[model samples]
Target: MTEIRHYKIGEDRFKISEDEVARRELKVTKVADDVIQIQEEIHGIIALVGATSTVNIKKDELKELIKIVREEFGWTDIC
Candidate 1:
């Protein structure tokens, strides 16, 4: 069995798991355009097409994003 830990970056941008990092399954980085890129890897080596969105989100936008991610990905309750 593999032990997994969690890592968080930025103030409110990400919540990553140790398994994800060790396997390179996820990546989130802030680009110079004030946007964040969210990536996921599949099948051990295949890289899925990722999404990039503005990171300069206000309170309302943050709430919306949290809601969407929660509904789609089952993220932890942020509200």
Candidate 2:
């Protein structure tokens, strides 16, 4: 079974998972914008890891990998 996780970005809350479920609705706030920035930072870290690795992964794959890592590390409150 695929696990589902929800996140709130700038006025744009969404859920991600290995499954194909639609995201839940969320409210937008200044904090949400900040969350988006942190998410970008997470993506940056993933990009860096990809750059340093021998594997030639695409940006989308890197993003998915990052999400998995974050979930494993219990980094739900990254921002």
Candidate 3:
């Protein structure tokens, strides 16, 4: 059986899944001043594809990102 879950740690959010074919993960973290980091990865026969991006964002940009993530993940609150 495959299982998928979403959770949060500190100022970060995560979604992880493990199944027969692959393991997939996504994470968002607020790092330092005006910076946020986003990462995604998939582990499988194709040699794990891991990618990461960092954005130096203003308060409004951060708020927009948070709102989008919260809506996508069905969360009422996030840090």
Candidate 4:
């Protein structure tokens, strides 16, 4: 089994695991600013695929997903 951890960057929080950290071709370093940087491998692949097949999720939807994950893990707000 793999263990995942969630951390709040400023006010928002997200779940990420050790495996994900290692495998992520794109990094969401500063979520608050919505600034994401993709690695060369990911960039090359994305360039070929293009950004046409994308789903735009609302902020509320993302918040709900985060809430569900947090609740499932019995996480508490320490901050």
Per-candidate Cα RMSD to the true structure, in Å, reads: 14.3, 15.4, 12.2, 13.4
**Residue lDDT tens for model 4, 1-79:** 4444333312222335443322112211222222222222222122255555443345654564456434544435512
User: Top model by lDDT, which number?
Assistant: 3
Off by over 4 Å in 2: 1-53, 75-79
Per-residue CA lDDT of candidate 2, range 1-79, in tens?
4443444332222334454333222211223322322232122112243344232334554565456445643456553
Better of 1 and 4 by TM-score: 1
Q: Report, for every candidate in turn, its global Cα lDDT versus the true structure.
A: 0.41, 0.36, 0.48, 0.34
For model 4 the TM-score comes to: 0.25
Sorting all predicted structures by lDDT, with the top scorer first, yields 3, 1, 2, 4
List candidate 3 segments past 4 Å from native. 1-20, 48-79
Q: Ten residues in a row with the worst lDDT in model 2?
A: 37-46
TM-score of each: 0.29, 0.26, 0.35, 0.25
Backbone clashes counted, model 3: 0
Clashes in candidate 2: how many?
A: 0
